[model samples]
Target: MKDIQSLPPGPKPHPFFGNLLEFQRDQLKFVERMQRTYGDMVTMHAGPRPFVLLFRPEYVRYLLTEHPRDFMATQSAGGDLMEVLGESLLTIEGEAHRQQRRLVQPAFHKKRVESYADYMVQYTQEMLDTWHEGEVVDIAQAMQQLTLRIVVRSLFALELLDQIDEMGRNFSQMIEHRRSLLARLLNIYVDLPFTLYGKRMSAKRRIDAFIYKLIRERKAEGQDHGDVLSMLLATQDEEHPLSEQQIRDHVITFMAAGHETTANALNWTFYLLAQNPEPREKLLQELQTVLAGRTPTLNDLPNLPYTEWVINESMRVYPPVWAMGRKSLVPFEMGGYHFPEGMTFLFSQWVIHHHPDLWQDPNTFRPERWNPENDEKVQPWSYFPFGGGPRICIGMPFAQLEAKLLLATIMQRYTPRLIPGFPVVPKPRVTLRLKHGLRMKVERTATVVKDSVTMI
Candidate 1:
């Protein structure tokens, strides 16, 4: 074991700014380089704050599962997230987090999440209807719009359907602002309309107002709509029911997280399939045999194994929530090294997913890697697209179901081909997004088997 006081190896930091400039220039490359040069445990700094980047799968399992109490989820951009997400489950910790998670858990229960499948297919089909065979479309924007609609419908019922476009715009602005380097470095709080911080604040207020209005309307109706919002409003602890603010916090958290990650996941999936024709063909074959051009239901998921693998592989290559961070609540030792209190640990799914030690051809798009017959058994914490352990994404079931249904529904009608020479770059943001958006030409599938195939 290494000395408890010894710090991990990493690139030397520039005084004052530390490694902030290097990190800001390109976070993905920086993290990958650190792991390659310094091995599993790498230390760096963001301004004055020192952080340790853990690269091994065992390290991931330890922080997230084995000794979860030693750390807490670090706030985004230093409390900028809390300003937007409020005291929602994403930001809180300890018993309060447990209680809130308990109250909100039922909304994401397997049965409840499965109930949204029809809506998922319907919205996707509706989006597909707008595409013409020869038209060029931004697939990233399209996925974002479709998921925003599905999440709103599932969360608030159809009440927010009409406001989807406006809500989407505001949400987009909020995300851009949150991820903006200028916003993070400057910590500008000027409330003027011209400032970046001001504009994001405005967007937050608009969203808050819209949600508050809906909450009031729902409370007045006093009827369960069988949507997540209704479920949350009714759930309570022994002391009292969830207040409107608390419910709004959860709503905003769900709205932002619920759609953003899934949208990017689909964007990357389509891009991967377009690039790798064999997997694409296999996926199409699976859809053709299993779905047979029919809308996929939750029950159909069992038969669509290749579809799941494609998504799994895509996430492994380009995880939506690419990185996660945690702050030490107390001094701890791991990987034979010790950390001080308030130390931050950053781990990247992108790096781990692409780690040479963990995966073969780590950068290649290979859905077959997930096949049980492949002979390479994936260890625990080896692939966590939706995260892991107790605080794993509550919406994992919902996001998976939505992605599968949407992919099946769209592939049955249209095959999106990436435009030739179109540059697709991954932007490390609140999620892994295409920096320039995914521009693709829509081509109608010629051989979509219409006759339903019997499930074997």
Candidate 2:
């Protein structure tokens, strides 16, 4: 506790508020400034709490793995997520987390998750089918609606294709309110009228009622459908099965993470592809040669190396789950400094992914850098799109396969181009979303259609 001066250097704190004000203005820019001015590990304060920002991959490896037990996931950072998601694997710890993870792990296994590829491509095709040539569309919104429907269908075996518009309308309203400042700062779940929290809970209940109704239907069916809900229903032992509330938590967790995170990845990938025609062209070529105008499958995944690289590079630029905050559960020691318990530790995917030292041309969207022929090996703990270690995202394979299938399926049918003269920027909320969403014009591909009619 007495070694405070040995901590990493940072901007001088305000006498009262510390560096909280500066941080709130623009978190990404402020962290970038801190890394440049004070090196990789910068110490800043949120109010009176000390937070050390760790940027290096070695430091990331150390914190998430080597000294993993010394720190704990902070509720302050994911508290808002908890209220909306309840106590599924994301917010729990210890034996409960392990147990829940074991229950859910089977759903994301390679064989099982891969079997859903047809559903992935089918849903993607359904969405693309609605998009006529020469039509203008918000690709980001399109992706959100698409992924939400995909997750709902693939996870629950329920078709929301026709109901997507209504479901998405309510879900988006809920998500917006859930991620609002009042919802985050206040951390109150009560439904108060004319307030964001109130609206969020209302929206949540709409989704919840739907989910619980489905759960009841599935329960009454008394047969396994091989969907996630069935697995939850099947789980029980000498002890006890999960309560309805717990199952709802897991369902909501999957709904938010499965749809939201993957949609952001797809949205940003197309955003980059719209600008970088070379990579996009190469991607189309791969789909033409390998897939030959057909949709991509898990079997084709390994063969489409360039397609994977494009998404990798996109994530490197804009990781969906950026920045993780944790609290020291014990007196923590790392980077040659000592910290007492309860100190905050901050890690930024944006900072680490863009660190000039780790990535050459860190700001450049060059997927070729990741090509196997280039012999480019990502340093351990450096490129964590879905995080790392034992607690690394369970849905990683699900997301990767889903994104690839969607990209390949859509790219086979249309060439997406960003609308001219629209400023696209990152809106870093719980997940990094596009500010105005990716507004783009879609042109039918010659492979899928002969006409050059535009979709905008």
List where candidate 2 sits over 4 angstroms from the true fold: 75-79, 178-190, 447-456
lDDT of model 1 at position 219:
93
In model 2, the number of clashes is 8
Please write out the lDDT profile of model 2 over residues 330-442, one tens digit for every residue: 88677888888888888889899999888888999999988867877788878898877767888898899899889888988988788889889887667788878888888
**Candidate 2 all-Cα RMSD:** 2.8
User: How do all models score by TM-score?
Assistant: 0.95, 0.93
Model 1 residue 285 CA deviation (Å) reads 0.7
Where does candidate 1 have its weakest 10-residue lDDT segment? 447-456
Could you give candidate 1's per-residue lDDT for residues 227-304 as a string of tens digits? 999998889776857989899999999999999999999999989988898999898888878876688888999999
lDDT of 1 at 408: 84
- Count backbone overlaps in model 1: 0
Error of 2 at 281 (Å): 1.5
Which pairs clash in model 1? none
The best candidate by TM-score is 1
The segments of candidate 1 whose C-alpha lies over 4 angstroms from its true place after superposition are 1-5, 76-79, 159-161, 179-188, 448-456
